[model samples]
Target: MQSQNELRNLLQRIDHKSYPAYKDTRGSYDFGNYVLSIDHVQGDPFAAPSKVSVHVRGGAAKFPADLYRMKCRRLAVCDYLLRQFGQELERVSFKAKGSGKSGLLAVSRPGQEVLERTACQMDEAKGDLVLRFEVGFPANGRTVNARELEKIFFTFLPECVSHSLFYKALDEKAVYRAADLAEDQQYIRDHLKEQGLVAFVADASILPRESGVSGRPMKDAVKFTAPESMKVSFALPHAGKIQGMGIKKGITLIVGGGYHGKSTLLKALELGVYNHIAGDGREYVITDDTAMKIRAEDGRSIKKVDISMFINDLPNGKDTSAFRTEDASGSTSQAANVVEAMEAGAETFLIDEDTSATNFMIRDELMQRVVNREDEPITPFIDRIRELYEQYGISTILVAGSSGSYFHVADCIVQMNRYKPQEITAFAKEEADRFPLPEVKPPKQAAPTFERAVRPDRAFKEDARMKLKTMGRDGISINRDTIDVRYVEQLADTEQLAALAYFLKYAEIHVFNGKRTLRESVSLLMQYVEEHGLAAVTESSYVPCGLAMPRAQEIFACINRYRRISL
Candidate 1:
């Protein structure tokens, strides 16, 4: 350990030396109020920024214990502090600057929701708060600028720490309010099934986006109001007596014309797995965490999945049970996705016809008449949807515009017209009774069992070095293979991707074995994360600063997509 003055002197001694000289500055320094640690140094100015952390004792910061007494509340405080630190960094203009990435400071950037992250952590047992961030470490071309580096360490950082860490410098009410909102959202989600609902959208919530590509709420979007038939209310701990449209746990349909908010409402429901910020328009919208969005992914890989429930009797003698395909058709892929979701413990399915396979969704009377039941290999989802709910307790919320065949099986129906939902289950039932289709025979086989053997050839060596990198939000490159997750709609943030990449590598090293199934391995990986926090995934010497928690479902999907899997 060294004093701040001594660290400054070391930086001065390394000035104008080769870039490798910056390595000597990697050590802990006592800065009175906080202890600063430069855990890792960048090899070059153009390389990734240096890893740094600041630790402030609990007594110095004076934060209330209640703020972190609960896991959800603690995460909220960590998110708030990260935002405050980012704001402080934006306010400061460094006096010394040089080449690429010089004089820049950054923490993990947050999305619309607050998540458990490694960027900031509070250890109540140790009575300390640790904030991890990245610094460029000022440089002149390839040479170090010791004077500018001293200013960053001794001057700029202390101000950021003071304003962001101390309870007095922050708006206490705002922080508490954010935590309360997060808690209330969790409470609502926890009670959704108890209330006999699959999803809930609060009254006055905005469901429209700024654009098709943008996730931000529209400026003049219509406020949501529940129809009298579907409107339900819940009394939460922090937020008392909130009213919303509670989608019941059964086969439900949303039907309307084009551009009439059918997809928008479903989008909100899909995203409801996460608790939004207070002013995020859909803050009170909550759904089951196990709810997975089902869609057609034609090019995705399927490994040893039991999609035989929906697909069987191929043209050739291709077995649907223990199915393995490198490139699946649209209908086959959708069926596999649903089965995989079920294997991973998905309780509810959210589907939109726009993104679904036309033939897989429904085969009407005309098509059934043209092709005999014995001749057709596919069983439309409409026939099995009711059976899925009644037998398995699995619920489905589907958006359908072209087909009324689903009306026969639907327990609830809501029409979205001009951005407003209307309960039309009665109307839909009457229409179905007036013009019913031919009675269809149920499939012969029972639900297929999901089982797969771990491939012994895919074993990961303990001493082997492997690298992981995130390719946008939907893909991760691990060693030589690229895991495609483009159809995984639940992965909302890049931080989650980064964390997932680390978890995959971590799983390969620690959890994978020939004895454990992929699902079992993923469960063990999640259990490890639960016990050790997100930092456990990273092997870097410095604390991992940008990791966010991802659901076990997504992690399982990632592992299944790896082409190296053997049945």
Candidate 2:
């Protein structure tokens, strides 16, 4: 490796050269304390930034092994470092005259939630910590700006590395606290069934957010309190012997008037699948990792899904067993969503009445009297919810403010009042008995199959020019088509969407064949990630820094939404 001064001299000599001349700097430079490697160079200043990495020996960085001993803790530290790097980049005020994204310094930007990412990795075996980031190298039009480049590499970078990597320079207490929170969150999720619970909310947990789009907690939000009937305690590794409301593993209903915190509590539970950062107000909240949030999507495409369990016997005798639709109604779309989630291995379903189709969720006795059972084609969720738990061992947590028909099937009922939850299963049962629920016939279709065969398509092949870009947090642009994931509520961050796009491409090239089911394909991709890390998905010479782990469900959801699927 060349010395840092040698790199500086090379940059000075290359000043005023064409931007392509920057490619000559692609090599390792020894900076005494750490080694900087320019792995890939951009074609021009207008293109995506060049890939850069820094490696510090364990003795130099002085980060304790315990800080990253556990996988959860390691991911937390990586996320923390990424955030620090972003802040440091913001402070650099240098402007090298150039066009489009020129002279910019950036790292993998994190969202509200902290997740395991590939931006930073700890190599315990090698005793080295590696940080991968991007740099828009300085350029004046098409020529190199060596002075500005020197400032970025020699001055700004070393400071960022010193501040973010060293133990003494960091807030040690905050780092340990974030790691501990993540550990406790994982512990709660891992032992949910052992504690006879599907979800948990600690006594002082904050349920209300500041607004619709904000993940930050609302100021003066009421602290959650568990009713005596539903209260349960856990002995966590870090925060020992904490008490919380343990939602039982079966049909659960959250019921109350509007603005009474019913949906607020449900929203908290939905987000509990992810481990939040320290002081995020929902750090202690935990739920099953396989939980999926389901809602009605009016225009989603469905391909060969067996939604026959929920809807059958159409007016024109359409085949519900192998349903295919370009534009589905509210009820059919909701039914398809549930079946698709099941195929993707969801163990718990979270639903809110506000976003759900009214007819699909319930059928009152009045409606039963007005319309004969044979005339109605849709089998409401109320009829199959118990069967979901009893037959398939699946659990559901539903928010119902307008319907009490669900009370008859719910195994546990929690009523929210002023953001406090109280167990009201018996009271709900009494009320349900007073107002009789409609007796509905079960659909005569066979049990839905989770497996669907995907034909090998050339569109995702290595030779294909697949353009994968994230369209915010809800959608992705793949080649010429866009995959809409607005209703896939569990996709918590944009990084996951970005990673999913690449994973789909990886699957098309490496995992997918004509014989394997979509689920099998996703499993293979996940197995690859587990063995090779997230960086393995990238086919380019430069390692991407903005990838977060995505669930198999979300991966297949993106694949299914692709317009070229041949089911």
Model 1, C-alpha of 447: deviation from truth (Å): 2.1
Q: Candidate 1 on 18-82: residue-level lDDT in tens?
A: 88898998899999988999988999888998889998888887788888777777788888888
Model 2: how far residue 476 lies from native, Å: 0.8
> How well does candidate 2 match the true structure in TM-score terms?
0.96
Computed on alpha carbons, the lDDT of every model, listed in order, comes to: 0.85, 0.84
Colliding residue pairs in candidate 1: none
RMSD of each: 1.6, 1.7
Pick the lDDT winner: 1
- In model 2, residue pairs whose N, Cα or C atoms come closer than 3 Å (at least 3 residues apart or on different chains), thus clashing, are none
Off by over 4 Å in 2: 93-100, 124-127
lDDT of 2 by residue, 1-567 (tens): 999999999999999899898999999999988999998888988898888899888888777888777788878877787788778777773444466566677777776677777778876453368888888888878788888889888888888888888778999898788788788888998899998788999999888888898888889889999999988998999989999899999999999888999988888888788888876788878988888888998988888889999999899889998899988889998998888888888889999999999999988888889999889989999999989888878899999988888899999999999888989999889988998875666965778986687775686664655788998887988776788988788788888988998887787777777778888888888898998888888777767877888777788788877766777
The TM-score measured for candidate 1 stands at 0.97
